[model samples]
Target: MDTAYCTADGTPYYIANFAQLSESEIASKRRQLICVECRWPAYFKRAATSGQGACFGARPHAPTCSLGAPPSKKGPGSNEVQDILRNPMNHIRIDINYGAHDKVNGDPSDVDKANTRGGRFTGDGPRGPSPMNRRLRPLLKALIESEQFRNSNIIVELPRYTSLPANQLFVNFDAVDEGLANEFRGYWGLIFDTGMSADGSFWLNTGKYDDLSILITPEKYDDFKRKFNFQLDRELEGMHLLVLGKLRKAWSGKLIIDVDDVDRCALCDD
Candidate 1:
């Protein structure tokens, strides 16, 4: 776990030279790292104040990966997360009412009572489908890591829109067009580059066709950066972004999603 690949910059990141990056840069790199050998996902763990060196860890590396980092020990609720992810008939509700400062409410203990239709959790206790309010980050990670999840029939509940199948609710940036305008969805895509408009609005420019972008209004700029621990000066060209917002066509004939709150967005290094 001394080295990993940074998909954002397409380079091998060494742990020893970790000090060279600014705090913001380090935070950004932490989310985008992957195993150098097997290409499995990896994360950065900051050095403890007790003098332990900073290191990298992965959920589970490929079986053939030489690093030998064992798969993370799963708890009683761990398999349940994946179970609901793969089962099409399962329902997962997303509660976006929390603020950026609030903890991600992904705990299975907070299961939604409304999700009792198909009896996905009838017999099993702790191992059953713990249908609860999901956070965007984990759901976005699932979509990126599993093609089956992207096409799954899992029902996701969001504000105003109620519930819809995962495949219908999440749309890629390249697939987005004016046809989806006024429709609310979880718009996900890569960040080709970023820009700050003259009016102080921040734009996460998607390099996809038709000049698609995610706009962070001047009002939400500071919160957005603080929530994501983002630095506009950092090289964010290849980062993946997911925003829960309504698609709209700009006055300039460009497709865009204007994110109203920091809690409505998620960004990853992959």
Candidate 2:
């Protein structure tokens, strides 16, 4: 396992197999690297002598760390580094709910009249539950329990064009209200759309009601497509996305986010 803990922050850092630092480089940052589970100091060992290839471990005389134990041959092996990264908060979860009653100018007059009261549907009809209604509780839990959620800024995108109850869903979390939005880039939503432009730039839309757009630079666009093997046209069509990016409200009162990091965007799984 090419994993170590940062004594400075008590956070675990993974050194990928391809990017292992040289001994001297590792030594320079030694003060910041330690065991992932415990704060024990750790060091990188190159493969030649240890036969373990590249691995990280505490000094031989250091106190025992449970994760240092040898693997069991009978069961599936766990990759701790991958496990940490797989935590739900590390990825934004998107859920798009487009309902039937949301249709416009399609239903017959008789049917529409029957469902309408005061020019609006009397009951929930087809708009479905509000995004905040369904998502806020779980998100609050993630905020409390997930270390990655605390360390990294994230965006949780929700559905747009829905009539949320009392407009509660659009309100920012307490953290966001207290200047954390600048640090965490708190959740906001839109009916997301994406496509590749002819000029090789990537285009994104945040909502259906307006012409708001996001532009992914050609260089970053190509890099993400290559790194993730992502097909923007195929993946984003009619699919709602949860975007994590540097969000800014344009002078035109429209939102624009620049997604330079591949990890900043995720297709909503639910």
Candidate 3:
């Protein structure tokens, strides 16, 4: 998971920081981080040959994921190459080298991105609590002070760092001790599935994240909608198809929303 853009430990601590503002304002400012970190690798060669696109413009699931099977409307895996071909809901490669502008406009790294280019949004009140993460911090502080994690809800905490504990937000939530940590709130962010290419080469297709972006070309989006009986709301038809790619650690049949559409965007507000 290590990458030049991520922390030394390879976690995306920064992306979690975006929701503190209105989702739309994030793009005007925050995505600048992704554009610089992910899209523009210092070494030109690495940018072209080695990097996975910072912003995905397609689905997030690859065939190799545990729930490679379709969750939206399921039957059985199509044995035929054509059926698989007809519905590209299967594994698709994400082009690591993409125009910086395109990814930002798609789902955008943060919620507050839509109809914007650069700058930040501020001057607001009652924007809700700082975020769920802020609430988690004090809850963890109390657990450490009580010094009885055996009965405390603080789970997944790192071993004491010298005398300090790792922040509760970054503690590995997957490792939560269910028996003792049922009441402590935890954020169940979507789990994205990425994997190797059809040629058996590893690739970080962020599209496997189903929630990323559809990246459907203006031409293709229109063509698909006109040809099919399904009605893809005109606004969203252009966005990528979203569905949780995997089920192991993510929710089942979770709703998928177009990251850019004003309405679909609300599903993420949770």
Candidate 4:
């Protein structure tokens, strides 16, 4: 349940056990994560996008849509936080199947995915889908649902993020490293899964969300020590690894492709 994210300036943002939290805390962090996602340059505008690479700016990289105002971690949260308020238990039970199915955003429930909504496993190799753009969903949804989209004339994708604190990254990474008996450093928004496929498809496909780019900055990574003491909790560390191991086992080994390459998606051709 470790989650990873990058800021608009390309700084890494993460929280190790980001996914494994009480509905309240996870929902809170998710709000911050959403800001990071939409804070980028909109893809269509060259001014904003000329220097900006991530598709989060909401205006196609136009200076008009520059990530001009950096998000204050202390600012208001994203509405996706509403999920918890809408149905806390459903939010808890909405298994995202990180790395295996969709990268994050808890792959869409059965009713949403179509062949175009490719749901392959990342473990299956390059043929599978890529990791989820954990940040985009709520942020994009909010902007589009608001006057933001109405105010512009550009096509865009959602941003992804995990919205974890600095200390939590180490705690969760260490958890999954041991849990899955592998070296998974981080993930975006992910939830626990229910079961795995028999033939090793090992993944689920929820097309409700599209993928996003990762944002990493030197400051974001270097500030780790200032965030949390990694050595403080052994019990929580054990829990982290346990969660990862289970997540790996449930993956369908299909593909975790990004939404950017939909035309090439196997599901699309199928």
Best by lDDT: 1
lDDT per residue, candidate 4, 1-270, as tens digits? 112333322433334344334665532333233223434311110112125321222211232332433332232233342322232111121112222333323445552243224332223334323222222223223232233322332222222323232223212211232243232222222211112235422222211121111111233222221222233211111111101111232253322322221111111000
Residues 6-45, candidate 1: write the lDDT tens digits. 8888989888776478876764665567889888666565
Q: How much is the lDDT of residue 186 in candidate 4?
A: 29
Off by over 4 Å in 4: 1-49, 52-77, 85-171, 182-186, 189-270
Off by over 4 Å in 2: 1-192, 232-234, 251-253
The 0-to-1 C-alpha lDDT of every candidate, in the order given, reads 0.68, 0.41, 0.24, 0.25
RMSD to the hidden true structure, all candidates? 7.9, 20.6, 22.6, 20.3
Better of 2 and 4 by lDDT: 2
* lDDT score of residue 55 within candidate 3: 32
When 1 and 4 are scored with lDDT, the better candidate is: 1
85-163: candidate 3 lDDT, tens digit per residue: 2222222111111222233245443322221211111224333322111122222222222223213222232111111
Off by over 4 Å in 3: 1-18, 22-25, 28-58, 67-238, 241-270
In model 1, the worst 10-residue window by lDDT is 110-119
Task: For candidate 4, report its TM-score.
Answer: 0.20
Score residue 180 of candidate 2 by CA lDDT.
Answer: 24
Give me the overall lDDT of model 2. 0.41
Model 1 clashes, total count = 1
Q: Which stretches of candidate 1 lie over 4 Å from their true place?
A: 1-89, 97-99, 102-130
Candidate ranking (lDDT, best to worst):
1, 2, 4, 3
